[model samples]
Target chain A: MKLSEILSLLEGTLVSEHADWDLEIGKVAAADLMSDVLAFADPESVLVTGLVNPQVVITADMADIVGIIFVRGKVPPPETVAVAREERIPLIITSYTMFEACGRLYQAGLKAVDLES
Target chain B: MSKVSQVTRLQELVYELEIAEVMTRDFLSVTPQMTMREFKEFLQEHRFSGAPVMEDGELVGIISIEDLIEALAAGELGCLVEAKMTRDPVVLKANDLVVRSVDYFGRFGYGRFPVVDDQGAIVGVLTKGDITRGLLRKLEVEYHQEEIRRARVNHIFDDVSSDHTSISLRYDVEARNFERGGRASRSIKRALKRFGLPRQIVRRAAIATYEAEMNVVIHADDPGGVITAEIQPDQIVIEAIDMGPGIPDIDLAMQRGFSTAPDWIREMGFGAGMGLKNIDRCADRMELLSPHGTRTTLRIVIYMDER
Candidate 1:
C-alpha cells in the first residue's frame, strides 16, 4: 500500500515530510512495546503504535519499518519529531485507537508479520 | 593540515601498511625448561605480559600472566613452563598485512601473538601496542607523501578553467548529523536542474546523491567525510569518501534489508539497508572501494549523454 493512501484512510496528520508519502509499504505491525515492534516488524512495514517516544522511531530504523502511525492521537515529543525528521522516517498522528488502526490496515490488505515466516 | 588532507593521509595509511614493516624484530622469548615460578618473575622483572616459549629454536607454546595466575590458582605454580604454556598458539607471519592482524585481534581478543619465520621459528612478538605504534609512524610518513600528491594534482587542476564544459562541487557530510543529511543531495539536484539537465537524469542523480550522503552520515566513523560531484559535458560523477569502519561484507551490505544500524538510529527512521541498492539503481555505473575497518570510497557515475 502507498503511504499516502494509508495516511488519508486514517485521517492522520503527517509529521514527517511529504517526500516519502509515495513510498510503498507492504505490511503493517501495530504494537505498544518497542521489543514487539522490533521482533515483528519487517522492512517496508508501516508501524502502528500508541507509544510516543524516540524509541519508536529508533525501532523503526532498526527493523527497517517504513513509516510510523501514532494512534490515540498522541502528540510525539519534540525530540521524537527531531529524530523522525533526521532519520527521514515518515510519521503520522491519528485519532484512531491501536486496535482500530490495526484492523483498518489489515482490512485494507496490509499483511501482518507472519510468525511462520 | 586541512581536514581533507588529513582524511587522505589516513586513507593512504590503511592502503600502504603491511605487517612486515611494523612487526618488532627484537623480542623476548622463554624456554620450555623455565619453571612457572621463574616465568612469573621474568614477566614481573621485564614488565612483560607474555612471551613465546621456544624449544630448540622453534616456537612450541606461548605463556602469559593469565596462564601464570591460572597455574597459581590451581596450586601448580611449580609446573614446568611447557605444562602451562598454550600449545599451537596463534601466530602471524611477517609478510601478512597489518589489517589481518587487526582482524585477528578483534576476533580472538588476544593481547599478543608470536611473529614467526618461514622456518617456524619465533622471530618476534606482535602485540596490540606494536600495531598502534607502527600505524602512527606509517601515518606520519604517508601523510607527507599524500600532501605532495595533492599539491601535484592541484597544480594540474589549476590550469583548467571553470566553464560550461565542466564544474565541480564538494560537500562535507557529518556522520549522524541527520539535520544536515540531505542538504548535499538537494543542492546537487538544484545544480543539475539549473544546468538544464533532463528531468529523468536530474532525478537519478539526486537520488544517488541522497543515498550516498546518507550512507556517509550513517556509517562513517567520528566526524564523517565528504562527497564531491563533478559535472562534465558527457557525464556526472559523484564520489563519497569516508573515514570508516568500512563495510566488512560488501555483498551483505548491498542486500535489500541488511543493516548494522543500532536500534536508536533506526528509530529515527533512516537505516532501511536500501541506501546502496537505491544508489545502484539510480546510477549507470557504481564502484565501491572499501578496505574493511579502514576507509570507504563510493563512486557513482551517471552518463548524461546516454539518454
Candidate 2:
C-alpha cells in the first residue's frame, strides 16, 4: 500500500509537508522500542506507534522503515520532527488508535510479516 | 560580635569522606582476568554508570557503560576490556573532598571513580550518580562552576534540530580501541530517523554514508583519520578521508568494470565493483581527492527538500 492511500483512507491530517506519499509500503510494525524495531523489523515497512522521541526515528531509519504514522492524534516533539525532516521520513497524523490503525491498514490490504517467521 | 556565646563556633559534622561511602562493594568489577566478552556481559547485567577494575585486591582501572557504548559505536572486535579500558584509573582518596572528585570527573568525563585506601585497595566507588547527589547535598558554587562545566561539552551537534534536521550523536573513531567501524553509518541512520527522513531517503543516506566509511577503513591504511558527517535542515553530508594509500586511478575506480577489493570484501556482500557506483547512485554529489601514495578523501551529499 502507498502511504498516500493510507492517509486518504484514514483521513489523516497532513501535519508536515507531504512528500512521496506514493512510496510503496509493504508490512507494518507497531512498537515503541527503538532497539526492538532495529533488531527485528524489516526495512521497507511502515512504523506505527505513539512513542515520540528522537531515538525512535534513529531506530526506524536503522531498520529501514518507510513511513511513520503517529497514531491517536499524538504530535511528536520538535526534536523528533526535526529528525524526520532531516531523514526525509514522511510523518502523518491520524486519529485512529494503534490497534485500529493496524487493523484498518491490514484490512485495507497492507500485509504484515508472519509472526511465526 | 565575637563574644556572643549563643553563636558558638562549632565544627560541622562531615563524614571521614572516603569514596568508599558510595562504592558498591557487592557489585563485581571487571579485572584483567576476565575476557572481553565477559566484560560486555558485565555491562549488560548492571545498568552501572561505570565500574572500577580490580585485580588481586588492588584497583588498576575503571570501565563504564558509557565506555562500552562508545566502544560499541566504534565496533572493536575481540577482548574489549584490554582494548577499551582507560589506563591509570583516577583515584579519590578517603579524605579527599567531594569537590575534588567533582572537578576530576567534570574535567576527565570519568563516569565513575574508585575510592581507595592508603594500601591501594579499593574500599568504595564513586559514580556520576554519586557525584550528582554530592553536588546537590553540598550547595555548590552555582554561578561560575555550572557555566564552566557546560562549556566543556562543546556539544558538536548543538545547532542541530529535530524540527528540520536529523539530530545525531554517535562517533566511531579510535578513541580507546574497543571498536572503530560502522559508527558513522549507525549515527547517520539514527539521525535520519530522529529527523524523520523519508524511508527511501534514509536508506540512501545510510548506504551512501556506510560505503564511504568502509572505503576509508579498507583503503586508508596506516594513516589515522575520520569520517565526518553534517546534518543541516537541507541535506546530510558525509566526508571520509585517510592519510595513507591513495587511489591510483579515479576514472577506473569509478567505473563498474574495475575493482581492487579483496575476496573477503565480496564475501561480505561488498566490493562487487559496486561501491563507487552505489554511492554515486545514492548521493546527490560525489567527489574524490587523492594524490596517490596513501591518503584519500571521499565526499557524499544527500539533500532534503523543504516542501
Candidate 3:
C-alpha cells in the first residue's frame, strides 16, 4: 500500500514533513514493543503502533521499517515527530486503536510481516 | 572489567596522551663516521635493533640491526654508517597524539620512530613499547580519578549504584492529539544516537518506547501519560505510566488481533491489538501493571550489548 492510501484510510495526519507520501509500504508490523519490531519487522514494512516515543522512529530507522502510524488518536511529542522528520520516515497519526489499524491495513491487502512473500 | 568501561578507557587514552610524553629522550645515535662493524657491536651490547643517525644535532638517517646484517652479508662491514643507514626516515612530531604514532607504526611496520622538534632536531626515540607503557600510565590516572568521583557520588547518594554511567530523559504523551505524536520517541532516539549505542539496541529501545507512549495516549483516560527512559552504558530502560482505563483481560490483550477500541478507531487504522505484545517482544525484560482502571504502568529493558 502506498503511504498516501494508508494515510487516507486511517484519516491520519502527516506528522513528518519530509516523508514521501507516495512511498510504497509492502508489508505492515503492528506492535508497541520495539524488540519484536527489530526481530520480526522486514525492511519497507509500515510500523503500526500506538506507542508514541522517539524510539519508534529510531527502531524504524534501524530495522529499515519504512513508515510509522500512531493509532488510537495518540499524538507523539514534538521530539518524536522531529526524529521521524529527520530520519525521513513517513509518520501518520490515526484515531484507530492498534487492532483496527492493523486490520484495516491487512484488509486493504497490506500483508503482515510474516505472511508477506 | 566491563565492556563499557573498557571502551571508555580506550577513548580516554586515544584522546589524552601525546607522543612527547612517551618517547625516550636519552636514546643512542650513530654518526656517519661510525663503521658498520662498530655499530653492530653497539646494537648487540645494548640489545637494541635500531637508533637514529645524527650529524650536528640533526637527524640525518636511521640505522637498524637488519642494515648491519645486510652489510655483513654483502662484505661491507668496513663501510661507514652513511653507507648503511636509511636517510630521511619517517618521523613523528612530539605534539602528535600517541594514537597517531601507533598508526604510523602499523602502516610502516617500523620498530621505532624518531621524534623531531620544530627545528628538525631529533628530540627522542619512540618505540611501540613506549607508547603502550604511556597509555597504561594514563589509564591508571583516569581510574584513580574515577574512583575518587565514585566515592564522592556514593557518599551523597547513600546507595551505591552500578558502575555504569547513565542518562535519563522524560517525554509526555498527550491523549488524542494526533498532530504531536512521536515527539518523545524522536528525542529519545536522538539521545541514544548521541550516546553512540549500537544500532540494534537503539532500534529496540526506540520501538519499545514508542509502544509504551502510544498505550498511554490511546488507552488512558483524561490526564494522558509519561515515559521515562534511562540510558546506561550497558542497557536502556523505559517506563511508561498513564491514567487509566486499564486492560481488564491481560491474557486476551496480549494476544494478536484482539482489541477493545471503537469502530471509528479501527477505521483510522489501529486497534489490531498488538501494542503490549510488541513491547513484550522488544524488551529483554518487561513489567506491566494494571489493577482495574486506576493506573497502567509498563517497563521495558533492553541490553545494549547483547551480541
Candidate 4:
C-alpha cells in the first residue's frame, strides 16, 4: 500500500516536514516497546506505536523503518519531530488506538511483519 | 576520526579558535599623558607600529604607525599622545570566534584591534599576523593527528594477499545514555559500507551490533561497555563487553519476553528481553559469557556469504 493510502485509512496527519507520501509500505510492526520493534521489524516497514519519544525516531532509523504511525492521539515533542525530519522518516499521528490503527492498515492490505520474513 | 581536507580544516579552525586564543597578551600600551616624542621613542624601542592607549587600565584609543607618521609630518612630535591618538576605536570581545576577527579585519581595514573582557578592560591585541600564526599552529597539531588516522585507515586496506588481513573497530557505550545508544552501531555500519560489503551482510551486522549496544545502554552499570567489530575476508565478529552486576540466571535472561528492565526503560521502548534473541537471529554463531562479578561479553559471528 502506498503511504498516502494508509494515512487516509488510519486518519493520520503527517507531521514531519520531510515526507514521502508515495512511499510503498507493505509491511508493518506494531509495538510500544522499541526492543520489540527492532527485533521483529522488517526493513522499509512502517511502525505503529504509542511511544512519542525521540528514541522512537532513533529506533526507526536504526531498523530502517521508513515511516512511523504514532497512535492514541500521542503527538511527539518538537525534538522528536526534529529527529524524524533530520532522518527523513515520515511521522504520522492519529487519534485512533494502536489496535484500531493496525487493524485499519491490515484491512487495507498491509501485511504484519514476521521474524521469518 | 573522519576525513577532513586542508581547506575544511582551516575553515573549521577559523570558527573554532577564539579571539582570546589567537590574540597577543602582555601587549605594550602607551598612556595618554605621554608626548608623541615619547610615544615615538617607545614604539621604536618596542619595534611596534601600533599601540593601544589606556587610562586607568581602560582602553581609550588606538595609535597606529599611520597616526605616528601623520604626527611626524605635521611636526607635532611634542603634542600629548592623547591629542594624536584615534579615540573610541573599534574593539572586539575576547571570547568571540576568530572568524569574527577575520570579518572585522576585512571590513575595517585596520592593522589591529584591542580585545576586551566582560568588564570592558583591555586584555589583549589581535593582529592579522596573530591570526595567521594561530591558525598555522592549530593546523599543524591537527595535521599530525589526521596523518595518524590516515595511516590507520590505509593499514586496513593494504596487502590483500596476506595470510590474514582484517580490520577492527571499537566504540565505547555509556550506561543510561539513551541519547547516544545507537551511535556505535551506526558508525560500524558506515565503516562496513565504506568497505563496499554486500548490503544484506551489512544490514545483518548492523542490526546485531545495534541490539548488543542497546543491551549495554539499558542494563550495564556505570562507565558502561565496549562494542568491537573485527572484519576478515570471510566473516565479521562483534563483541559487546560490559562491566556489570552480572546476570544471575543466563538461561532465563535468554528466554523471550523475560526482561529485567525497569518500567521507565520499557516505557522508552526498550528492555523487552528480546535483545539477545535478536542478536541470535542475526548471527550464525553466538556466545554469551557472564563471569560472576567482572563483566558480560556477547560474541556474535556472521559469515560474509550468508544472506
Candidate 5:
C-alpha cells in the first residue's frame, strides 16, 4: 500500500513537514522496544510504535525504517521530531490503538516484517 | 567543504529539500472582487510584485504589477481584479522537490509559483530567490556538521608513522546511564563511517560495540568503564572492559535466553541475554574474560576481508 493510502485508512495525521506520498510501504513492524526493531525489522518497513522519544528516531534511522506511526494519538516531543525531520523520515500520528492500527494495515495487504532471517 | 564535494552537496540538497522548506509562507492575498485601483494600492503597501487572488479561501487567479500597469495604461483602474488577472495559474506542490520548481521556472518563465497542499489550498509561494536561499542555507548547515565530525574523528585516521598502522579510539561508558548508554557505540560507528570503511564492516562493528556498551551499563558494578576500538588496515578489534560483578559461568552466560538482568532492566526492553551472542555473530572472533568478582573484558574482532 502507498503511504498516503495508509494515512487515510487509519485516519492518520502526518505531523512531519514532508512525506513521499507515492512511496510504497509493503511491510509494517509494530514494536515499542528499540532493540527488537534493530534486531528483527527489515529495511523499508513502516514502524508502528507507541513510544515517543529521540531513541526511537535513532533506531528507525539505524534500521532503515521508511516511516513511523505513533499509535493512540501519541505526539512526540520536539527533540524526537527534530531528529526525524533531520533524517527525512516521515512521522504520522493515528488515533487507533496499536493492535487496531496493525490489524487495519495487515488487512490492507501489508505484511509483517519481523523475525529476522 | 571542498569545492568538488560542495558541488555534489548542492546536488544532493536540491533533491532533499522540499518546496515547503523554501517557500514564502503567510503571504498576503488579494480578493478578486477588489478593484484594480485597490489592488495597486495593496501591492504598493506590501511591495509585492504579484499576489494570488483568492475567493472564499480558494485560489481563483493571480494578479501582478504588470496587470496594474496595463490597467493604468488602458484607463481601467476602476475595473475589478477578476477582469485583468490570469485565471488557472500554474502551481507547485508544497511536498515536491525544489528541483522541480527549477525546471518549472525554466519552462514556464513565471516569476513565482504559488505552492499548494494536497487539498489544493494555497499554502505558500516560491520564487527563484527562495530556492537559491534555501539550498545555500541547507548547504551551510551540512558543511558545519561535516566540519564538526571531521574535527572529532580527525585524529583517528591521520598522523600514523609506524610501518604497521593501527589507530585506537577509547570512550568512557557510564554505568546505569540509560539515557546515554549508547553514546560510546554511536561515536565508534560515526568514526568508522567517516573513515569510509565498507558498509558491512561499519555496521558489524557498530552493532557489536553497542551490545557491549549496553552490557556495561546494565551489569557493571563500578561507576564506569572504557570501550576501545583498535582499527588496523585489515581488521578492527573492539574491547569493552568493565569493573563488574563478573559472570560466574561463562558457558551459561553465553546461552541465548539466559539473562541475569533485574526486573527494572528487563522492563527497559533489554537483558534478553542476546548481547554476547549478538557480538559473537558480528565479530570474526570473540573473547570474554570474567574473573569471578574482579572485572569483565569482552573483546571482539572483525576482519576487512571476511563476510
Candidate 6:
C-alpha cells in the first residue's frame, strides 16, 4: 500500500519531514523488542511497536524501515522524533493497542506479504 | 595470530574497566562556592568527565572536565562554578533504561550524563565508558544468544543432512521499507554461527547476502523471486532469483556509481552501485550471475580461519 494511504487509515500523525509522497509499504511487524524486531521483521516493511526509545529510530535507520508507529498511546521522546526526522522515515503515533492495531491493519485490506507474495 | 588485531585490541580496555566491575555508585559533589582550584583538583583526582555543582546543599549545576579544561586554557581556573560549569547538565535517574542512555549517545554524542536521586542529589555518574561497557556486556550476552541462532542458520545450510534447503521470504519490492529487508539475513547469520562459521565469515556473508536480498525487494519488480543461500565446507553461495527483466551490461552494473535505483534508494545511503563492489570486496570469492529474466546469484567464501 502507498504510505500516504496507510497513514490516513491508521489515523497517524506524521513526524517526519522527509517522507516521500510515493513510498510504498510492503509489510508490517508490531513489536517492541528491538532485538526481536531486528531478528525478525521483514526489512521491506514498517515497524509498529509500543516501545518509544530512540533505538527504534536507530534500528529503523539501520534496517531501512519505511516508517515507525508508536502504538497504544506511547509517545516518542524528542530525540526519537529527531532521529526519525533525520532519517526521513515517517513516525506515526496511534492510540490502538498492538493487537487491535495489527488486526485493524490486517483487516483493512492491508494485506501483508505472503511467503510467496 | 594476526587475528590478534581484533582480539587483543579490546583486552586492555576490558581489563582496565573490569577492575571496578563497572561502578554505578554515582559518588560525586561540587559546591559552586568551592574554589576553582578545588574544582580543577576534583577533576584531576576523580578522573572526572564532569561533576554536578551544588549550592547550599542544593543541586545547582554541573562542571564538566571539558569545561574545566577550557577554563584552564583560558586562564580562568579562578572562575567559579557559575562561570565554568554548565548551568544545566543532562541528568537521568539511576533506574533509567540503559537504552535511553544509548539514545543520548546517538542524539548528542555525550560522553556522560549525571545520575540523580529523587531529592536531586547526585547518586553516581554514568560515563560514556560505563554505558558503552554496559552495552558491550549486553551485546556479549546477546551475542551468546546469537550463538544459538547462528547454529540454527548453520544447521539450515551446513546440515545439508537436515531440512533447511531454501529460505522462503514473503516480501514486496520498491516498498522503501527498511526494517523487514534484512530479517532473512539475520536468520542466515545466526544459522551460520551455529554451524561454527567464523565471525568474519558470518559478517561478510551476512552483508553480501542481506545486500543482495535488500536489492531484490527495493530495486527489482519481482516479488516472486527466491533468495536461495547454501553453505559448503569450502564457500557460501547466495542466489537471488527473480523474473524481472535483467540488467543489460554486467560490467557497467558492477561499477560503483552506476545504480539505476530510485532517489529513495540513494537517500537510504545504499543504492550506490557499490552494493556489488561491497559484496565483492567482502567476499574472498564472489561470482555474480545474471541472465535475462535472470536471477542474480552471488557466491561468497569466508575461510574458516579467516573469521
Q: What is the interface RMSD of each candidate, in Å?
A: 9.6, 10.4, 6.6, 1.5, 2.4, 10.1
lDDT tens per residue, model 3, B81-129: 9988999999999888888987899899889999998776789999988
Rank order by DockQ, top first? 4, 5, 3, 2, 1, 6
TM-score of decoy 1: 0.41
Give the alpha carbon lDDT tens digit for every residue of B1-307 in model 4: 3456777878999999999998999899999999999999998999988999999888889998888899999999999999999999999999999999999999999999999998888899999999999999998888797677666554555745677878889999999898788888878987887676787788788888988998998889999999999998789999999989678888998999998998888878888788888889889999998887468999999998866
Q: How would the docking of model 6 be graded?
A: incorrect
DockQ (Cα-based) for each candidate: 0.05, 0.07, 0.12, 0.43, 0.20, 0.02
By summed lDDT, which 10 consecutive residues of candidate 5 chain B come out lowest?
A: B152-161
User: Largest TM-score belongs to which candidate?
Assistant: 5
Candidate with best DockQ? 4
Score candidate 6 by DockQ. 0.02
* TM-scores, one per candidate: 0.41, 0.36, 0.43, 0.60, 0.61, 0.36
For each of the candidates, give the backbone clash count: 6, 32, 46, 1, 0, 21
Q: Candidate 3: misplaced stretches above 4 Å?
A: A1-40, A44-63, A66-85, A90-117, B1-164
Residue A102, model 2, lDDT:
88
lDDT assessment of candidate 6: 0.66
Off by over 4 Å in 2: A1-117, B1-180
Interface RMSD of 1: 9.6
Query: How well is each residue in A1-117 modelled by candidate 3, as lDDT tens digits?
Result: 678899898888987787787888888888775546755887788898877877667667767688888898888888788777878887788998888888888889988888322
For candidate 2 chain A, the 10 contiguous residues with the lowest summed lDDT are A32-41
Model 5 residue pairs with clashes:
none
Candidate 4 docks with a DockQ of 0.43
TM-score of chain A of each: 0.93, 0.89, 0.93, 0.96, 0.97, 0.87
Measured with C-alpha atoms, the lDDT of residue A68 in candidate 2 is: 82
The better candidate by DockQ, 5 or 6, is 5
Enumerate the chain B TM-scores of all models.
Answer: 0.46, 0.42, 0.49, 0.63, 0.61, 0.44
